[model samples]
Target: MELKPYRDNVGALLFNGAGLVLVARRADMPDAEGAAGGWQLPQGGVDPGEDLRAAVLRELAEEIGTDRAEIIAEHPEWLTYDFPPELAGRGFRIAQRYRGQRQRWFALRFTGRDADIRLDADSHPEFDAWRWAGIEELPALAVSFKRPIYEVLAQAFGPLARALASAAKSR
Candidate 1:
């Protein structure tokens, strides 16, 4: 079988003032995979000609119901990850269109209170539950296929995460 092109996507690593990264439990993962309740960072496809910055912010609002965050830093390079064969054509509608995702990740500082987050804000909620987690915990919490990307993110964003945590503690 010929491999398809990767889908253009954006990912958000929303860090709260306390320096914890936001993760959400997918509401639609297949139970057979035993990853039905797996957690992941907020991510979504980028529209044609849409700015990456805009796409990240839009995805944040659409997925978690808040755009009150501000961009702090962005991954210097795009990261690509392929879907595990079992997940191909079984997860997102985008799965039917592409082999996997080529994502531009961003670190955003959550500027609003937890009350500002509304999982039900969208007609179709992607996540059933959300929480702030330590950045190092991302890889283990993410699904197997997405683990590599989350691992890279944890390293790339480590210093920034630490600085934010320090700032929060000082306040």
Candidate 2:
């Protein structure tokens, strides 16, 4: 067996004032899959010549309808995951050509109200529904292949989320 190439992708861990992070259900995911928790953070391919930070914000706005955010931190390194073989040929943009994603993750603090989120903002929307979920719940909510990434993020961003939530409470 040979290793396949990965797509260069940017992912967001957008945190609200309440400390919960944003996660969205894929528009293409089946109802049963959605019910089984087919949710993930806002992410997308990095457009050629786009900066990593710019890509993250663009994905947030394109996927969730708002880019009102400030970058707090970035994951120290790129993380990679494999696409499950069973998911091949299903028409997922990321799965079509790439083995999976070589992801650069960022932590962003959402600066806008919940009403700012419009799932239909993009003519080709990536997600259908979204919600603010506790950071600890991320791993459980992620697809099996992406669970480890979510686990890492939960540990990596947990402190910042708490701090932000606390700060918001005091405001």
Candidate 3:
């Protein structure tokens, strides 16, 4: 099935105390136009009448296989970015649906153990594989369009991650 680029969407970022962030690899899902190995935080579009926070939780469950995770913080405002023409689907350009996505950033804490991750729980798995990576490493791993957002995320979460690192050292 192909999405007609409705231009309306939402997503979230789940982080953990170890200073490691969860990232997923895109499934080689047909009609999806992006690099397969490219990594990103778990996220999906919001359903009609659904609250954004609920959408974030739903996506987390579907993508990361958990019904709940601790939300440490969230951006007070929404963050948005545009997709380059070449990176966009044909339908996206035809619909001209608001150009790109407007997402509410979330900072989540995973409460479950590593064994809890069920990568194949969904009808369409968003990721083929995943790993915990440094926040600073994300910009380098992300696609060009998402690199700027990674930079923003690094700045937004850098201090907390550092504090966690410092705490671990004192243990």
Judging by lDDT against the true structure, name the best candidate.
Answer: 1
Pairs of residues clashing in candidate 2? none
Model 1: weakest 10-residue lDDT segment is 85-94
lDDT per residue for candidate 2 within 16-99, as digits (tens), equals 888889999876766454443489999889988999999999988888899999998999999988897756766666576789
Over 93-132, each residue of candidate 1 has an lDDT whose tens digit, in order, gives: 6666677889999999999999999999999999999999
The alpha-carbon root-mean-square deviation between model 2 and the true structure, to one decimal in Å, is: 1.9
CA deviation > 4 Å runs, candidate 1: 33-35, 89-92
Candidate 2 segments exceeding 4 Å error: 31-37
Regions of candidate 3 where Cα sits further than 4 Å from its true position: 1-8, 29-35, 87-98
Candidate 3 at residue 114, lDDT?
77
Clash count for candidate 3 is 0
Give the count of colliding residue pairs in each prediction.
Answer: 0, 0, 0
**What's each prediction's TM-score?**
0.94, 0.92, 0.81
How do these models rank on lDDT, best leading? 1, 2, 3
Model 3, range 71-104, lDDT digits (tens) per residue?
7778776676666665446444422544567677
Evaluated at residue 105, the lDDT of candidate 3 is 76
The TM-score measured for candidate 2 stands at 0.92
